[model samples]
Target: MLTGTVKWFNNPKGYGFIQAQEGTENQDVLIHYSVIEMDGFKTLKAGQTVSFDVGQGPKGLIATKVLPDNGQGAKVDNTEVLEKDSSLA
Candidate 1:
């Protein structure tokens, strides 16, 4: 997952961009409003930490399944967890 802060989201426009987290690449990711949790759209600000999946789009990588990754948030990097979540996590 890639992390970034919300650059700006024009709800009516149905899209937004995220400035990649510090120490990350110098590029921003595209985010479609629908990919995020509905309730978070309002509370999310210009600099909130979020994790997202990278999808290859016609334009480029698009952010999907965006969510607040708490400081202690563990990445989905463990095979055990992925297997469990896929089956019973």
Candidate 2:
């Protein structure tokens, strides 16, 4: 698994891009909602840290088995995330 930060995510669009950590081959990886492993509403927020596996998609690099970093690396509170985005709530 690779660690990275979410550059941006569109809740309604159900897609986003992750900025890979320094020294990674891919600077950005596409992340789709389907790959998120969260139990509730699966969504990511900008600046959020995460770990995931990479795979080749039809378009290009994609993130799979995405897991949110709930430890020290994570900055945003999951509840705040849901509250901030009313659409996802």
Candidate 3:
């Protein structure tokens, strides 16, 4: 697995981009929310550190089997939830 930081994620769209750390040729890898292996909140946040495997998709490079570097389950912030709700309202 390679280490990287999430560049950005669109929760509603269910996709994101991960900027891989040094040593990987594919810097920006596409990551889908479905591939993220988190317990509760299967979502990614920008600036969050993560480890993942590179895979070839129909379009281009993509991040697969992603996990948080901290090894703990991802926690969904209440503020984020509220923001999402407010946006919808």
lDDT of 3 by residue, 1-89 (tens): 88899998988898999899864685589998888986776887889999998888888779878997776535666897798899788
Decoy 2 TM-score against native: 0.74
User: How many residue pairs collide in each prediction?
Assistant: 1, 0, 0
Ranking under lDDT, best-scoring first?
3, 2, 1
Q: TM-score for model 1?
A: 0.59
Model 3 local distance difference test score: 0.83
Worst 10 residues of 1 by lDDT: 69-78
Q: lDDT per model, in order? A: 0.65, 0.81, 0.83
**Candidate 1 per-residue lDDT over residues 1-89, each given as its tens digit:** 77788787665587777787643466678887677754533334456678777666787668767775563321233587577789753
RMSD of 1: 12.6
Between the candidate structures 1 and 2, which one is better when assessed by lDDT?
Answer: 2
Model 2 worst lDDT run, 10 consecutive residues:
69-78
Highest TM-score among the candidates is held by which one?
3
Name the candidate that leads on lDDT.
Answer: 3
Off by over 4 Å in 3: 72-74, 79-89
lDDT of 2 by residue, 1-89 (tens): 88899999988799999998853585689999899877667888899999989888887789877998873332345697677799865
